[model samples]
Target: MTNNTLLLFSRLYHHDSRVFKEFLNQLPNDEQTMPINSTIKFEQQTSANHSVPDGAITQESFKIVIETKLYGQEDIDQIIKHTDSFDGEKNKYLMLINVHQIHEDYKVKIRNKLNEKGTDVQLIDTAFEDIITSFRSVINEYDTEMSMIIDDYEDYCNGANLISIEDRLMRALPVGDTLDHNFKYKLYYAPASRSYNRRHRYLGLYTRKEIKGVGKIELIVDADYYKESKKFKWEVVEGNKDQLTDEVIDNIVQSMFHGEEEFGYQIYKGHRFFIVPEFIETKFEKVSPGGLLGAKYFDLTDYGLVKEELDTQLIAEKLKEETWK
Candidate 1:
């Protein structure tokens, strides 16, 4: 629904045809013969559904109509209308950019429409995840300004939950050996269904993993479990003690520990998971693990969390010292 995203994509496609072609290659049935250095022209609002396709790319005998989407699911008829504006020549394509998987039925309908019109408008469905990754693949080989743009756009997509996977692994271990065990880690999946207005905002300790069928799954500790146990009760944050009604605490604890029924104690295929923190009010303290997962049962110092961002030399000196926020 936003033109800013379309403008950004148009800029990237025109700026580097190679990256654009690389993105096109993600389509299973696409056969892009446009030269790597072809003189490509990218424009927006130029189709029958003048508003349907966000942009279009043209080079020699190729014309690619690109439609970018984040959460919108346009009807197949909206896309079919684009062929009406086509000149019935060149290698035409209709590309849909979305995060969710496009159903096979829609693809069939699109192909049938194009066939009836006698146009070679092939359908290319590209997930936002793949689009962001394509930009990342060629990000390092670009000029400073272009590189900054791609970097900024990638960050924007990630923040919007359009692309679920994290660029880097959130690990506590250093490159070499592993002798330290100051923090315990939990692997959990944060499905896309929970992306919009997630109830829990204090997902302090977690990592994102890309599952085959599931978009992005987060791996984090069982906060409610760690908090309810006798081992962790002592370290509960004092600020929210009055609000922690017995009913509320019981609900949270039960919800966290109860495994997913559909998947049977796993997210999907042995992927252990936990619920995000909710109704827990505590200061956003970096060193205090008392809010949800308390210091009594687990220490922030376990994974070198406190020392990593502070000071290395100071961390070395306080290797055995307790951490306080």
Candidate 2:
């Protein structure tokens, strides 16, 4: 199945865009090949004149006939209208929206063409900018691995497992409402018997528990003195952010968490003994030195390290950490 798609990728490689092209090339043959009535390049609006491969994507299948200069939602509607004209047993047209001199929002807008699958557009994992960011690191690794092999410029490349880098980016890329369990966190804390005042920097501890389900988690933390309002104020952050703790000294002047202070610094976001607001905001990032700690499904390669290996458990703490609104 991966082999069928590999054909189209080979041609994408020759183009100037190495990252997108290489990613296209590396797609393992997938058996999920759909009947491609035709593929359109949205850069210039026009129909491709090439012959569609019978159940196989060929090298030149991605070629464009005319560079589409259309922009805005109206342009997208026009394209969708045109795409409907193509005879698909089930209208499966592959469209690439590549406007070179545009913003990221525009790119996202292009992907938002909204298809029948409830999905507006499908984005391939690898892209041009990702490769550029990683190019230096990859070259450095290549230099180290094959120093002995390269006698001259002609024989210079080490070409290590570049797929790993691409895969890393792919794993980080969140799709739809589907959350990556790897990015999920869980409960890890000592027990707290009694509640404390908000002014006293109350320490929170969580009893061990597991998380389940699919949806965006809304986090909440109660403010100590919302007496009149009768509403709890929440301390929240993005899905997998972690908080650092430093009970040792008052050097934490601003109290707004001024980065890592010492070695014994424990990690915490809120207290165990307090009630929280219903809807807290995730306003901070790079929360602490602890970073966001969660075990991904893919991280469970070694059975020896695992006490429990359910897919849900793999990132329970993470999902809980993010979802405990």
Candidate 3:
């Protein structure tokens, strides 16, 4: 898996070194580690002088030794051994790419060991998600062929489950007469039995075969509506309920009333309510038939929306003008 990922990077670099450099610039690195006017070389499990094992991106002035970890597993001795590969480079780096952040204690130990060896290599820690983000950031600059290659690489990563589905996916729900209420209160409610392939961090409002709005899911509550008492008993199922204030609760009740008036409280006897701080208006059209029969998930990153610093309003605006690929 690690070699496959490194090969993708090498392919991208060979296609256009500038794009590869831009991708690297987006990663967490020092100024000294940045590549300049030097011939770039991509090596896989090969040594500059029979040292260095994993992947590496080398330049005349600097070298970046990459060690990829699929899980959080780290071997201190193995990592220390790679330090010997950095021989008198002006700027040397040991880039640890993992699915999760490396522990601070491990980083401390690595740094201390490097100091002991008097090696000048800088240790940089990043994740697979970061790599995807950086690559996506520069993807728009390339033409169709290059863009397709980038997409293929991303698809490969997705197939390998290197990028988390839950983190990048947005669940789209169909709306009818309650569309206005959903937009007004930024809430959506449905029967608790509605099946979902996976948990999602975002929600999209679908109406007229088009996604009209999008929002970051702030809370999901399991609610039981009582028609006799004209009230609801709810428990937090996904998010922090403590963040739900009196004003928010009132809005939720209002949304429930609107639903009950149209579909009846019985329809919501045991339901799930999804709440968002605000809904950003959008018009993401569904080109295919069978208009959103059930919950549909779309990978937001597939559309080049950076999940880390995602702007709902910006996404909404982009959706209005751009066609879904």
Candidate 4:
């Protein structure tokens, strides 16, 4: 399944090398094994006079052997064996593409094994998500046929479960009296037991049948609030909590206290908080009746509100002005 996807990309590269070069530039190539001014050709299941069959992207002076795994945890022996395919090439590389990020320890093990054999092939580890993001970044919006190809490739990845649909989603939650408060602190809290999909990267603040604000979620922490002591203790359940500082904690505590006082109840006890570095104003009105209940997920890609290279503020601006298609 994964090889077929590579073949598609290889064929696309053959059609237009310029766009493919941009896509390749997005990948992590520290040693710069990819040739700049050489003729490039892509082959699949090619031996190149070797025993082990692997994909090859060859140039005049360099060769990149691609070993793809639908799942992570590749065989070290097989990978090392692939190094034999490079024969007197000025630049040689062994690219490992997987569905998950290859662990650093695993890469170290591969490097150590290669060293034991005195092999000089450079190793490149990347995930399918990175490839998709890179391809999307370089796609020309005016080229309708190229856009269709990308859509088809993305659909295939999504169908194979190689990519998470939620990553392109923006989940909107209804805000009540705490709308201003949420915007003020760039935080939102709810009961820990509340059932909602939490995989989304962007959160939309919905009120009055319209989304008024949005922010990229930076951290999500589960906390236990003690009203008697006026203290809160939290442990990160998702995102980088290392950025969480004492000042941020104080702000969250103050927000919790204000919620308790306004709602006449302990809203902070056993709650999960979603914190963002900053929230930007937006206006995405909903056409459906009965307002938003619970949470609603919008496909930011489908709406053209997001691109891999776009920042949060740009996305907010697009959301504010663009109408849902």
Per residue, candidate 2 scores C-alpha lDDT tens digits across 283-315 of 112223432333222222222224233332233
Question: Which stretches of candidate 3 lie above 4 Å from their native place?
Answer: 1-163, 265-268
Q: How many residue pairs clash per model?
A: 6, 27, 0, 0
Q: Which regions of candidate 2 deviate over 4 angstroms? A: 1-43, 47-126, 129-325
Candidate 1 lDDT over residue span 1-325, tens digit each:
2344565556677776676676557555556543344576667777563445667766676776777666544576677776655564466777777765465555667778778866767777777666656666665563777677767777777777676322221112111111111111122333324432221212233111110010112223223234334332312211233444454445434433444432243322222233222211112223543232321112224535452353323333333343333
Sorted by lDDT (best first), the order is: 4, 3, 1, 2
Per-residue error for 255 in candidate 2, Å, reads 6.0
Q: Which stretches of candidate 4 lie over 4 Å from their true place?
A: 1-155, 165-167
Model 3, residue 55: C-alpha shift (Å): 28
Question: Regarding lDDT, does 1 or 3 come out ahead?
Answer: 3
Each prediction's Cα RMSD?
Answer: 14.4, 17.7, 10.3, 7.8
Q: What tens-digit string does per-residue lDDT give for candidate 3 at 134-202?
A: 877887663776677667777877787666666667888888666788889878887788757566788
Candidate 2 minimal-lDDT segment of 10 residues: 166-175
* Candidate 4 vs. true structure, TM-score: 0.55
lDDT score for candidate 3 against the true structure = 0.75
